[model samples]
Target: MAVLDIKNLNVAYKSRNEKVFAVDNVSLSISEGDSVGIVGESGSGKSTLAMAILRLLSENDTEITGEIDFKGKDLLKMDINEFNKIRWKELAVVFQKSMNALSPIHKIGSQLEDIYRVHEPKIAKQKLKEKILSLFKLVNLSDRVYNLYPHELSGGMLQRVSIALSLIHKPPLLILDEATTALDVVTQGQILSEIQKLEQDIKMTRIMITHDMSVVANSCKKVVVMYAGKIMEVGNVEDVLIKPTHPYTQGLMKSFPTLKGEKKELSGIKGFLPNMSEKNKGCIFAPRCSFVQEVCHKVAPKEFEIKSGHLSACHLHGSEIN
Candidate 1:
């Protein structure tokens, strides 16, 4: 059975009396223990999709629709009280900025205790202490740093703390939204490796959201390529990275330098991301696509199944159905 399933999910923000859609008609299903990566450039709505699933977006200025089924339960329709029951215990998120997540004035141990006490307030002090210490050890942090302030920790340590917090209750589903984007290259690589190991050890279904295609190549088993608030392509890591069907996905891989292949200059895609406030009838990426056709600019393309699990949304693949 699928651990997380989203059907026709749409997320839009109110801006100057206009709605700027961030995620448009995205449907995806992730099975148990699957490491899926949603990759796209900034403003591609990958992060917005993550935030929407977590119910972190403010309902006052945002309009969200469609079902977000988590293990057979629709999270979007869940009441606040009911949602809180599983928010951090069964599902958790490690956001992009780790340095700002912790309070500068408080000790790490105290803050961690507060988080634990929220869900398990009746637990004994001794048990809480054991749990905190165990989480610290699991994240490779020394027990001595437990009492240290946020300012006392390095960037990498702070990120580790963030990860430790997300795993506090051993969540079955974990989402990391650009979790390691702020760290140095070496630190990011180390953390990505650790994340992979954590998946194996804890058997957690994870969603890794990032703008870098390389990150997806390193950490994810399945990859979803997003562009202009829409999913352009999705397939297993090896298939998507090795043979991208969508032009946007191909351009993304072309921009990244490969170590195994012959040396080639990084020729990034032309033009910038389109404005999200305005909805277009045709393909959103049509303006920048090298293979843009007359039909691409006149009508939107439906998702075509290229293989068993591989799908791409492009007019070039439309012939498979029509």
Candidate 2:
């Protein structure tokens, strides 16, 4: 069974004047031990999708629809109490900023203890301390660092601690929302290597959400490309990253730098994401797409199968490669 399955999931934010749909009818299934990357530019709702899965959005500002099934349980229907039971046990989140995630005043050890204290109540305090120490070792931290506060550790160490805390319960799914965004290249590589080791060692499933295609290309087995709150494409990482069917995907790949080749100036997508509250008549990317036609401006394109296990939402699906 799929560890995570989201179908027709839609999320909207409310204001006094209108509702803004941030995620629009997106569907995805992640099997056990699978590594999936959701890639998109900022404002494309990639982070919102992750937050929605965790049921972390503030209820007053947002409305969610459709299903978020985790191991046959409908997460959308779970009450707060039941959801709390699942948060750090069945599903865990490694948010984008480790600084914001870790508490400044609390000792690192205490924070680690809190995960077990909340979820695995049956365990005694002594056992929890032992487990937290074991977790520190598992993430390659020195035992002495456990007593240090968040400010005492380096950025890399804090991020590693954040990762260790997230794995405290050995949850089935680990959602890394740009977890390495703040680190240097060397540190990021180290963390990525550690993540790969953990995945292989435990047969864990991971969902890495990042706009960096290089990270997605190196880490994920499957890829989902999002643009303006809609999925532009989904396919095997090798196939989609190497031979992107969507124009947007192609543009993203072209923008990546290579060591052995001549360096070119990097450029971002030209136009802005359309306002969600505004009435969008057709494809959301039509304004920025270089290959857009009249049909793209007048009607939304249906998702078409470009190859086995490769699908794209573009008008040129059956035509010449973009």
**Candidate 2 residue pairs in clash (backbone atoms < 3 Å):** none
Q: Report the backbone clash tally of model 2.
A: 0
Which residue pairs show backbone clashes in model 1?
Answer: none
Candidate 1 structure quality by residue, lDDT tens digits, 1-322: 7999999999999877799989999999999889999988888998899889989999998999999999889999999999999999999999888558788999998998898888989988788878888877766778888889999998778988898899888899999988877677876776677667878988889999887778888889999999978999999999888888889988988898888868988989999999888898999999999889999988999998988889999999933211
RMSD of each: 2.5, 2.0
lDDT of candidate 1 vs native?
A: 0.88
TM-score per candidate, in order?
Answer: 0.94, 0.93
Superposed by TM-score, candidate 1 places the C-alpha of residue 237 at a distance from the truth, in angstroms, of 0.4
**Model 1: runs farther than 4 Å from truth?**
318-322
